[model samples]
Target: MGGLRNLSGLDASQLVIDGDLKISGNNNLESIADLNGVVITGTCMIANNPLCVGCTCGSIGLAAFTTSTTTTSTTSTTTVTTTTSTSTTSTTTRNPAYEGDVLCQSSAQLADAAALLEDRLRINGMVAFSNYDSFTCDVDATTLASMTAISHVEALEIRGSTALETLAGLEALAAVEFDVAIRGNAALSNLSGLDTLSSIGLDLTIRGNALLTSLSGLSSLTHVGGQLAIQSNPVLETLDFMTSLGSVDFLLISNNPLLTEVDALASLTSVNTLYVFGNDELANVNALRNVTIVGDCFISGLKDCVSPDACSCSDL
Candidate 1:
């Protein structure tokens, strides 16, 4: 027992107990066969082992000697040590997912999703860096705040965001480009104060917001470089603000089931492609005299025009 500490025959991976062992060392193992943290493969055969005398069949083959582990005294008190260095100097911190970043995806990962350009994006540049140049936020019906606190986005596409309740704060956008597609927000009801937008460089698509009843928000977009489609917003009884739009190359307003009058569309002068169909209550095509677009004008429900306009749909 005296020369056993200096024997240097201990294996860290596998320990074999051949003798009837008595554990004594507080931090060392006099006999590791008595420990519980270690695993025993063969029939521990507690019935045959010497330590388990009165234990029942429940503790039949195994035993726990967690209390008996004691430390052994060595000639030198240098304990075991790990070799790997514990340095954390070069590790980098990562950014968490949040609002106001270009290209946000739910399941399908996006490409070129550059991290927040600068942390303090609101104060640095005139152009909204929190701006979305080319991206789609096809969120689930549960993520309704898809329109919250949207301070600066260059181009935003909202598709299949079904639980969107309101189109609020979009009136505050001063300069948004590319496309602002609010499609499939089925629960959207109101677009109250969106007349402040003065300049747009691309298309503006507002489709399938079922409960929207007014065209009051889009009264200020004076320049659109591409198409403008507002379709399937049912119960929208009036297009009273279409006269304020400055220019549109292609204008489409279709599938509104209950639209009655489009008095404001008579003032549109810059449209190059005009289409109004699927609206059951519409009974006049006289207001389409000013359109100069290049596509089919499917004015299928049009009637009762005192002066038939120069459109190729009816005037041809």
Candidate 2:
């Protein structure tokens, strides 16, 4: 059998492969720029090709290859190319379930990130802010506009944005297919930008945002497919923002020194597991008056919180 030196047959705009692609040890190959439109329904593997350069293998969108993959080049200096041109890219082919996580370290890379997010209707992996933790520049309207334009994402995490005062840029964000965790932003004051977010397909955790005093922006959220947690904000006064929320498997609210009430979560009716602790000002759980079922309950550390009759269920 002649080793494949040219992939002329696979160089079509609508190429489709029903099974895995395992191409390796080719000494004559040069570039995979021609296999741009190829779609493999299974896994892909390309390794030990001495002359092969660039991220042609990864240029094929990970969504096309639905299974695990690996790519090893001869020079050992791996670079990723994108289907659509973008300054930021990630090398993927390891796990089938995820295409790759995109990291945007600066505002200059926001365009690349927007391009990546705009490549498809949904992203199978993560889009993160790497340099936000210590960013000195403002997370401007243009940056937030790009981030908010993304309607479907697997996971969205923002950490340590010291100067961010609000989620004003993320106003258009409506859905997170998986988790949304916001932590360590010292200047963030409210959930004002996520005003349109109505659903989270998985967990939602808000922690360590020191200046955050309200959840007023999450007023539209009505469903959570997994857990809901709010913790460690010293001045947060209410859970009134999530008034529309009704379903969650687990609930956790803890460590807020000024949070005196949870009356905002009055709409929640189901929780399989719940833990409420560490808020010194919280006096009662009158908000859980509609909660009729709980599998396990852990409530302690709130000096004035009296056990309400609504949580008097058989399981806990």
Q: In candidate 2, which residue ranges exceed 4 Å CA deviation?
A: 1-100, 105-111, 114-121, 131-141, 306-316
Which runs of model 1 end up more than 4 angstroms from their true locations? 1-101, 107-152, 293-296, 303-316
As a TM-score, model 1 comes out at 0.52
Structure candidate 2, residue pairs in collision:
67-96, 69-93, 133-160, 283-305
Q: lDDT of all the models against the reference? A: 0.50, 0.68
Q: Tens digits of per-residue lDDT for model 2 on 185-303?
A: 77888888889889998899899888999987999998888888899998898887788988888888899988888888889888888888888887777788677555788777665
The CA lDDT at 53 in model 2 is 63
The residue-by-residue lDDT of candidate 1 on 15-48, one tens digit each, is: 5343222322222212332233222222222122
Cα lDDT of candidate 2 equals 0.68
Clashes of each: 10, 4
The C-alpha TM-scores of every prediction are: 0.52, 0.62
Who wins the TM-score comparison?
2
